[model samples]
Each structure stands twice: as C-alpha cells, then as structure tokens.
Target: MNYSKIMFMIMIMLTTLMTISSTNWIGMWIGMEMNLMSFIPFINKNKNLKSSRAMMMYFLAQSIGSIIFLFAILMNSFIMTPIMMNEFIKTAMVIGMAIKLGMAPFHSWMPEMMSNINWNEMMVLMTWQKVAPLYTLSNLMNNWSMYILIILSTIVGAIGGLNQTSMRKIMAYSSINHMGWITAMMITQTKWFMYLLIYSITVAMLCYMMNMHNTYFINQVSTMNESMTEKLTYSILMLSIGGMPPFLGFLPKWMAIQSMINTEMMILMTIMIMMSLLTLFYYMRMISSLMLMYSSMNKWMKYKSPNTMMVSLMLTINMSMPIYSIMSFF
Candidate 1:
C-alpha cells in the first residue's frame, strides 16, 4: 500500500484521460508526457534489479517515441492547412504511436518488459497504459499505415505466442492481437471504443485472476490444484480471453468482425478469426490440465473456497457482457 505510488498511478490515468479529451495536439502531448513520467516513477517503486532495468528500458523506449511524436507535432504545426500536411509527418506520428502501443515491429519491448514487472503492473501495461497512445494512433489519419500495422500485428502476435509458455508473454501477444482488431475498428471510426473498453475489462479480469493465484507461467496454470469453483472461474475467464463463445471477451471480437464485414474487409476479418482460434487453442491446451479431475481429490477440493473479493470481481466482469448489450440500447 504505497500511497505515493497509488497517487502516481492516479495521475497517469488522469493525464491519459486528459490527452484523449484534448482537441489541441500540443495539449495532448503535454498530457501524454505527464502520463509517461508518472508511470516511470510508479514502475520504479519496486527496488528489484530486474524492475530497475525494466524501468530504464521502458523509459528509453517511451522517450524515443515521445521525441518522434513531438517532431511530428512540430512539423504539423508549420502546415497552414490540414490538407497541406505531408505523408512523412503522418507516418512519423503513426510510427511513434505504434512504438508506444507496442504494435508489431516496434513490439519487441512488450513481452520482455512484461516478464520483468509484477503482474499487477503488467495489467496496467497491457490495458490502462495503452489508452492514450491507441487513441492517438486511431486519430493519426494514416489509414494505409494503420492497415499495414493491423496485418503485421495480427500475424506477429499470433505467431509469436504460439511457442511461449510464459503467461505474461502469452498475454503480451494477446494484447498485440487485440490491438490489430482495435486498429481495424478505427477504420470504421465508431466501434473501436467499445472494443477497447471490453478488451480492457477482459484483460483486467485475466490479470486479477492470475495475480490472485500467483500464477506466472502457462504450465503453472495447468498445475494449479484449486477447488472446482476456483478452477472453473479462472478457466472460464481464460476461455473468454481467448474469444470463446458465450463469454464477455467474445463480444468485442464479434463486434469487430461485424464492423470488418460492414467495411468489406473480408480478408482482415478472416485473419482475425483465424488468429483468435489459434489463441483459443493454446488456452485450451493449458486448460486441459485443469479439466482432468481426479475422483479422489474431488471430495477435498469441494470444501475449499477461493478469495471472496476475487470471486465477486470476476462475477462483475463476467456480467459486463449482458450489461454491455443493455447499455447499447441507450
């Protein structure tokens, strides 16, 4: 319970929210820098050697991205008209956002960085920390570059996760894969917000479960000897994250696919669906171990109870699926 770190985290969120709500590019950059600086201190709160190294790595990468972003902004400022802005400036902004968002080609830092941080910090890295950069990426006005990133991200995110046994790395790739869909949704311009919201909630749920169980590796998941209720709760959450049917995580993918179809992006939709299935395959692979119940262990396991708070949180997150639809009516 480090209150200073908590305050910094709150500042990060506030600054990012400010960035998104800003209409002026310079004000947005100011807010973005505040967000980055606040996160650096928060991440460095843990004094582990690995954490220190990770903080340095993250700081360097983010600084470089910020510099590039600032250059793009400066270049754009010189333009007298919106139509007068050059492709190079737009592409520069796109590249900067991609780096910050950890999209493919610029994504090497994410998995490595995630492995070095605590799971709770990793949750912020995967979800909340991404909001401003992703919103910026969506507004870059470079559709062609974004399209290329969408293809590259889905391909890289899928292939990269195929051989990983580290839960954090798997989640890193999952984040990238979801980013591809989010970027694609940007083309439709109206649906990316919903996808981002759902993705954030689903990711938060997965991270909370993982942190509660103290699970780090995929193999660790299979070996967890939790009670039936606990096992089933986490398993369902994992399946939902992998975009399986009848789960909250599936809703975003469903909406994304519909958006793609509406835009006649059949190939992109097919690739996203295929990659989603691949992700689910790996989740099922890990879950197979949990599903194999021993008859002798059943009696003892039935009596065990999991954390009440976590169970309540998971239930609330799961209920978001129906709640999302109900809210859509308004």
Candidate 2:
C-alpha cells in the first residue's frame, strides 16, 4: 500500500531532523526542501485529479515560503557570522514555520487538502509530518518569541474554527490551536516536554478514535444517525479536545498556564483562557450532535465497534498517562 511513498516520508523526516539540529539557516532550508520535495508524490499517491491539484497547490505554497526563508537566511549572512540571533532572520523563519504548521492567515491549503485525502494519509499529513519543521521553529526561538506565537496562534486558530462547518477545516483550526499550546510550552522546552508529550498523545488518540469510527465526515457521527456507542465516543472526544476537566486534553493547557504564569505573562494567560472559550463552541457542537436522543426512525440501530476492547483500553491509558504526568508535578 504505497510503501515507497511511506519510506520517502521517513527519509524526509530523518533528513529534516538532522539539518534542523545544525547551526546554519542554509542547512535548515535544505532540510525543509528535502521534506517539501518528498511529500509531493506521497500527497498524490491516489492519482485523483483533486489530489494532484492539492499537491500542486501545496508545492507552490511551500515553494514560496522556502524561497522567502532562503532569501532571509542569505540576506542576513555576513563575512563574520554573528553568534547571536537576528531579529529579522528569526521573524522570517517564524513565518516559514507558520506556513508549514498551517497557522492562520497562511493556512489555506491544509483544510482543503485534508478534506480530500484519505484518513491514513491524513493521519500522517496531520501528525508525523509536523514534528521536524516544528522542532526547527523551536530551535530558532528563545522563550520570548515562543510566548508571542502562543498568543497569536490561539487568537487566530480559535476565531478561524468558530465559523467552520466542514469537519477537516475544524481539525485544521484545531491543529493551529494545538500549535499555540505547544509553542507556549516551548518557552521551557526542557521543563515542558510534558506539555508537548501530553498534547501529542491526546492528538494521536483522537486520530485513532476518528479512524475507528470511520468518521471522516463530521456529519457521520451526529447523534441522529450514529449508534449509542459512537455517540458516547463523540462526547468523550469532544471533552478531550476542548480541554474540559477529567479528559486528557486538559493536561497540556494546565501546564501551559503554569508556564505562562511563571513567566509573568498574565495578560497572555488571560487571553489564552478567553480564546479557549471561543474554541469550545465547535467541539461542543460535535458533542451536542452526538448525544441527541431523537431518532429519524423509532427503531434502535446497532453496528459493530471498529475496535477491540484492548484498543479502547490502550487509548484510555494514553489519556490517563498524561494526567498522571501532570499530577506528579503538582
């Protein structure tokens, strides 16, 4: 099942991981190029005209970002290389990474492409593919810029998701919101690995749940048509996604708040909390849709669960593990 494309993606990640750890912007740019080139064929593996068009659009967008990133690197190059970070160069790099991460104002391609792509492909596209580029962004910033991005991302991500009816678009905006939490935690990258870890575990768990339910379309899981089990799953996932108490998602936001308070970013902390309220609407909409008791037909319907109890048990543990990690700190 397209093993070669999968292998290519792995190589791209490996290459990017190596280059981003290096000292020069040129090396990082090369790594990003490697990643961008490798993903083109992967995105088009199904050979649909739509997939091809999405790939083309992704390529063009990444190309522009790369060129701008490379130009910024070269523009600031000097005969005597400065040991310190350059503001302009860092800002350019920030924009480049934002484009890659599907942050708002630069995130047009992500939702459209995610909607059309297959779930397994979308799984990789949404998750594993983000690691290397984001790690690079973390490397480029100190605690301060990270804090700024955290706030900016929360603002744009929440507001963007507020108006979306499309399921993939909602996830795309959710990705941005997730990025905000991770970026905020980046201020103490070493101390806050817990935040990132919890966030990743939660995201992967949600993806697994989505896959199991065959819920590619949000409408598919609505309370009106889906069985009671699926509806139960929808409620749990919405709580987890919205970082409501007792769910796995709350852990990272908890850590991020602590980190922000320690940094004396009180205003930023307040803004993040406010934005979380905005973000809650879309997730709660999904929940309300799932738990609606009225049925179009008066008969109870049953369908086989797509998972073994073991899988459900494991995901529950994944969510629980992060909670324990958070508790230990307190």
> What lDDT score belongs to each candidate, Candidate 1 first?
0.82, 0.71
TM accuracy, model 1: 0.92
Q: Which stretches of candidate 2 lie over 4 Å from their true place?
A: 79-83, 142-148, 188-193, 223-230, 294-306, 318-330
Candidate 1: segments with Cα more than 4 A from true spot: 80-84, 293-306, 312-330
Model number with the top lDDT: 1
lDDT of 2 by residue, 1-330 (tens): 868976987877787686658676777778878888888878888878878887887888788778777776777877224346577777877777778777656777777877776666666666767776677777665734556667778888889888777666788788888788777677654444565566566666667767666776566666245554445555776777788766777877877888888888788789888999888888888667667656554333364554546345644654583557667879
TM-score of each: 0.92, 0.85
Clashes of each: 0, 1
Model 1: per-residue Cα lDDT at residue 119: 84
